[model samples]
Target: MTSSSSDRPLLGRRSLLGLGLGLGLGASFALAACGDPGQAGTGGSAAGGTLKWGWALPTSWDPVFSSAGWDVHSLSLVYAGLTKLDEQGTAVPALASAWKFSTDGTSVTFTLRPGLTFSDGSPLDAAAVKKSLDRGRTEAKSLVAPQLTSVREVSAPDAQTVLLELSRPDYQIPNLLAGKTGMIVNPKAFESDAAGLATRPAGAGPFTLTSYTQNAKAVLRRNPAYWDASAIKLENFEVHPLPDAATVVAGLQSGQFDVAQIPGSQVAAAKAAGLEVQVIPSLVVAVLDVNVEKAPFDNPKVVEALKFAIDREALLKTQLFGYGEVNHQPFPKGYVGYDPASADLYRYDPAKARALLTEAGHPDGVDLTLTTTAAQGLPEQLQAQLKEVGIRATIDVVPAAQATQIVYIQHAKALFTDQFAGRDSAAQAFQVLFGEQGLMNPGRRTPPELAAAVEQVSRTPLDSPEYPKVLRAATALAVRTMPNTFLYSVPRLLARRKSVSPVPAFTAVQRFEGVTAS
Candidate 1:
């Protein structure tokens, strides 16, 4: 068949990618943008004016029902979470000030800040927090439901206290609540105008989303009524969908964008243009997931063989401009679940890949596709590397917004590349990536060994000395059995005008609460 976005697969539901480039919403967000924060753009200028930041626009503005994990950043502008994560991946205060776990370890209580109100002038009390979290677990088609399954019940003991009762002794609640699952929705808006919320803000966050234009920009103004309004340094905060690399750098130089997320490849270009750059070690990892129910890859030997074909170090060095670390497991280094044994399990060897492919009944060769987003040079390099080992991989580039729907939900592609925006907790990441309902698992079934190992992790307390061992055991089983292949851990390369101060670093998505300018 001809290689096109509409072409039939040489590899059915078992394979996906070809350089068949199509443009729409995905084209505008080649995931890079440019402009000097020194020059102001449009309605506002720099720090005290408007922080014209280039990042991404969310598929859904509402947190409870948002599809993509990266949407947490956009959603955070309008809604406040029960807790927020710090640079160390520890849960700190947001709306909830202090929390304590019960003596039995099965229950935990959160103390909400006194007199907090939503932007819509509704009280953000304990009952509202309970309702929001309950919807996270029970809402139809909720993306966060899987991450919150351990919590069997949620109740508000008093106006200021919210309690969660777990099915077991899971001690990762605080961390798990750091992102979308932990965001507290305003109950009044859901009751009055739920549909309106898809475009507007109701929650008590730092900024109230004023205007959102699709595939273009989200215009937000600081909320004067915010609980900690003084922390918001900018009068306005605008986020645009980062476009092509050239367009991004051009925009930055022209003062069209103040702060933009540029590719690692463009750091030198940005720096030479008199812009400032910061390479923050982030939890973002790229994964190659396969459908084990299909041919070639369906065989265990071939599955293992493909592992040898990936040159993680080379990919890191070439594609990332040496700004990333080679990783074989989902968890990045310093994470408790990061396993050294898993990292040492696989290495790049084309001859070994070829030998294993021949042994698995493919002496001639194997042809497949390597699907990815519009991240310019990486997919082509992967395609070249795979070809050397007799795996001719076509490149398929999907749009950022539609990736989760087409690959993970519909399972249309046999094997696809996924860029994971790391979760708040290890268990949360495991549930979302390896569980039956995990977004990464198109197979939708966890093996018995993996299930048992993960269960041991869930039952163990997060602070327990043995927690890391149990979590590692689960990760190790997944690495050996699952068809999902982890490539590397890459940092988010951010560039700003000299006027802007250094952006705060967080484990997962970034928040603009502390970003300031001269």
Candidate 2:
């Protein structure tokens, strides 16, 4: 939920290819034939200079109040949570050195690392943690409210100990704390109405915001008093917020920026131009939101048919330049609950798809509209794939804002091509995309079997021995019901000058924790 509207451009800009989408196929094919990706570029040592990052500006610097991806991305450079999520979505220590959940699962106790303080010279103690968490839980405008809905109370039992009591048994608390919900704030710097924290943000991160120019850029200087001062390699960290993909590419091309989030379609071009293209396997997935509550897709056989109609491997190769891996389940491989067996459920077989379609009473195939944002040649690629299985897919392209309104708000009954990135856990993703309250399940039409599986996955303790089984079962049920056809996980590509040694990031949000550029 921390992602903003401008964060939706996984595909390259329509203008970058110097042609409209009608010419997308030619451009993509021509670009795909340019060179071998593996041999495109290589790595080098950091040059030890000021690291300049060209990216979209954050919507707000206040972590609790901001849901924009760019906002969280920028705030991360200036904030630290109690826990941090690893590349595999595992919870590791940050502010909190240790934590333990009660046997009954109603309360979790945490022990803070000794002698932590915010950059504002205020103590980052248990009381500060409680105050920040309480505000996040109680604030009506907080974007993380849904993630903290199970919390009953937050208490600071002692100077270094914090107790979190929940209304129900919830195991994802640690993971939640590793994200925006657990990003602590300085009580002295923030006001009751949540005013003035953006320009003058305060945190215990390795860097301190020296200046912030709205819609333009933010400059961060090393926090001399930071607990992990040794990790601060760069003397100055500068971020330029530029939303347009073309503009970002131009910046990278013109040597104006040392790093930028380059689109997948531009990876080859960036590499050819001598930029090091680093691939970050994003948590974001491209999915066809099949309207299982309506006709055509309502039938399970029809859903199965639709799933088998597309070639995921080819799609990844042509659409993403083979930058990402193919995934059949909604959860990618690194995330918890992702089953390798699920990949076998839907293979690219037109004969099988047509057979299933015939069994579902559509002998001549079904006519459906696949609506999506202007995602380069994705719609056309999907349309051609679906046509091979005797299905007629009409493409409807809309702007990103209007597309969100149509799919999430209007509950449009079309095969909506959507890109989703969410909390690290598979259960959290299910809750957002397929649960009874999920965005795609507007009618709450989750099958009884899947509903029970989702419940089990939600209630099961993550560390319990039964966790993997329960998660796998939930994933299997989800695939069977087929509310959404899983496509490949999109690769978040970035271009950096060879002089920079970018720290490898598993997810899209780039962390410069140990990175440096000369």
Candidate 3:
């Protein structure tokens, strides 16, 4: 039966109050109250000092339109996602207090918490939630809205209640919500043309955007009227964009920056300098993407040959400086439903590669161009490795700004790229890179089995008995197809000052709320 929108229940004042209290508790105590080391309750440990952080990308304040890496740090300070993943990679409630899924799993009901307000003192309720989501759906330029295609309709039963009707069952919906694209915004602050507001953003997070300068630095201050102001430690946060690795390392060592993201090669040096180094293994994989429709790669044998030619083990050890894990497929090892059996497909064999190349009508050798970006970690090393196996490779390094659209969007022939698959879920990773109409599916075609598996896995309930089995099979099939050659999973290295206490477990996400300056 098609459920009527009127069937949804109105959110109550008590429920909103409870939600407000819960949020207040979460913001104030979830990280510190857990009895973590170097952490204290309520008042900050640093006694109200400014903390500076650094990264390798320019600062962009727009959460919706901006795709820059450093911009995420700035946006995160102002915005909050509907849900967040815990250390174990499980999706937990964030903005939404709790949610209930229908038996068929086609619908989801979210009960809103009370007394939630935006940074600008505007009310945040079910109607506001609907407006924020609807804007993403209708806006073509929004990177986030595309991920919510499964959402057929959103209804507000009352001021604090939200009901979502999906076209199909989606167990990974929560993970999507935890992503940057799922950050909630005040409907009143949203502008259809967000270009002007990209410099200044408004949201309901622990911190507020105070000032920003593109490609230089961004400054954030504690929200005085924040729902949970007691939990915030440092009075202000300064995020500096230093694209150079040396500059980031120097900043962290000199104590100019309290926290910094250093390149993998610099991890050992930073650790030697007596800084707290938290090495979180990233879900990101460096891959050699081929345009299946384009010439040369159209031949399956050539694709197989290219896969066999590259040495993933050597790349992981030497090129990555042993900071990453060698992966045989898109899904990394240790992820839920990852198939150990699939490792055999990626075995290094130069002789077999030569044979495959000869069979693909390139007997002597194949001359192909390899396009990569300079900031992509180890593309040059990959090019040199490909050359040893009789393939003449020419490296074309493009700027990081234009690489995504030029390589993935434009379907450049042989591009070297890296993709960070945030969570360890097969459904989320597969959908992002290989689903029929996925954003990164440069091949632009889906295999029948892969399509069926993705659909089945997407509909499986989070707690279903068949969930793990179906996920394993789907991942195995994707590996065999070789849509993109999986190389390795990079390790995310964080250099933080020793005085900061209460560090959360290293997951794909790094949350600053849990941190307290001493």
Candidate 4:
């Protein structure tokens, strides 16, 4: 049964809110309350400035080679997607003025914004966009490749227009193009220096890479040639990946960082220090990936046992500090894809987990390793919870930069846990999380029933009144059948000085469009 539209924050394609996430979801708490998000952020200085941001750097500057999903946040600095998500996650025009689908929905056309140019002074026209998108879909190592499987061809109809031919009817294209999947790069730069993009980037974004140090810091200068350069207030922006909570607090207190991301535990500390804290809903979701090919998980009963073994509520309240809600599926509440049926599907029943383990031939217990990165913040708590059900889980902490390569690519462990930065479209999010050959699915096979349900969602248009209903059903199926299980939906917790405006945010990506002092 379909829930009331009120449960969803739907702003259709015609409006600013994309795929139903809302600007007014009662989100973004600041200093206990945010008077009006529309009002300029109060504490920051109200003039041209430089923002010293404490954020995790993405794996690579080149979107095609970037491995982590949250890398979209970092890539957005030097690269602008063809379209951007509004406060509600809707596909709003950025590089493109407008876009539309054909009568059959198998093809779409985008009208490029006039006079757009790359940061290096190259024309960012239809041909450049087609080239970049083609590279994303065709490049073997492109992490965004799974998101574009339905896209058969990319063509430039004219200097002002680009066309996409789909292998099937797909209305999710525009929203999918809103982030990393749609970010267009300068063709000349890549054609001449593809490898260099791992460190240096060239695009039509608000900023340009001035300097970069792997896993340390990156300095960027405002792009004078950006399409809406006049709207950009900061002259310089520097990003430091300080994943440590203590470091974030120290940086904020020392005035070394005007803006820094902190764990939910630091919310009170930030407020006590007179810093404005913006804790807003994000597309980020924490997920546990089980390698079905591995011994313990190879048995269906063992995988099912894990579903009941995890204590999601405890983790959310204790480890997460009650900042985010427990989630059974990848899509969070208030999203069009949220599935009510998935609620309480596997609610912390250790007895049931043990029974399933016994049925799976592990009469005594099961031994396994759970690999996680420090940035995930889900430490010993997860390990301790699993022990209750006779699942002896050894925890291995991997480096943030090497986690994906180690587990997803190397298959170094039987299980992995990390927070996935969500994609712009529900279809793309589903694909990356559940589809065959998905980065998260190292086992490389999606259960057929769940696959069919997801396929229907991909074909349905978000503007269709039935879109949410279809997506919800698919979400439920994913949780019920897939080895991957979601724990909770997390927000991007940030503390910023009164001198700088609250950093503009939606999902994992934060923008400095109007971050000048007030």
| Winner by lDDT | 4
User: Best to worst by lDDT, what's the order?
Assistant: 4, 1, 2, 3
Clashes of 3: 1
Poorest lDDT segment (10 consecutive residues) of candidate 1: 6-15
> What lDDT score is found at residue 152 in candidate 3?
96
Candidates' TM-scores?
Answer: 0.87, 0.82, 0.86, 0.87
lDDT tens per residue, model 3, 1-518: 11112121100000000000011111111111111112222334443767787763222344555553224445666776665556555666667777778888888887766766666667778888788777766666665565677889989999877888999887667666665556677776675445444555666666776666555566777654444456567677777765367766677777788888777777787888888888775455666667777767888898888889888888888766888788877655666666788866868898888889899999887887777656344666676777777788777877665676676566665545555453324465676567665545667777988889978887876566677678778878887874678787766677888876645653545566656775
Candidate 3 backbone collisions, by pair: 16-114
What is the per-residue lDDT of model 2 for residues 1-518, given as tens digits with 9 covering 90 to 100?
11111111111000001001111121111101111222211111222468888876555567776644335567777788887665555666678877777877788888887877776556789999998888888876676666687789999998899999999777667777766667888787675445666455767776678776665667777665455556667767888865366566667767688898776778777788888887776676777777766677768888889888989999988877787778787666665567767866787989999999999999999988887777458888999989999899888877764554566556675677766665545555676667665665544576788877876765776666788878888887887774688788876678988878865674634577677787
Q: Output the lDDT of residue 89, model 2.
A: 56
lDDT of 2: 0.69
lDDT of 1 by residue, 167-250 (tens): 887767777787777888888877677655565556777777766666788877766556666667787788888767877888
Candidate 1, 11: how far from true, in Å? 36
CA deviation > 4 Å runs, candidate 1: 1-47, 373-376, 396-403
In Å, residue 290's CA in model 4 sits off its true spot by 0.7
Question: Which ten residues in a row are the worst by lDDT in model 4?
Answer: 13-22
Error of 3 at 431 (Å): 2.6
Q: Write the per-residue lDDT of candidate 4 for residues 1-518, one digit (tens) a residue.
A: 11111122332111001111112222221111111212222213233668888876766778887655556777888888777777667777788887878878899888887777787767789999999999999887676676788899999989999999999988778778877788898999789989767767778787878777665678787777666666678877888876577667767878888888898889998889989999888777788888898988989999999989999999999877999998877767777777888877888899999999999999898999888766344758888888998999888877754666677677667888766666777777776677786667777779888888878977776677888888889888888778887888888788998998767766535677777753
Distance from true location, Cα of 199 in model 2, Å? 6.0
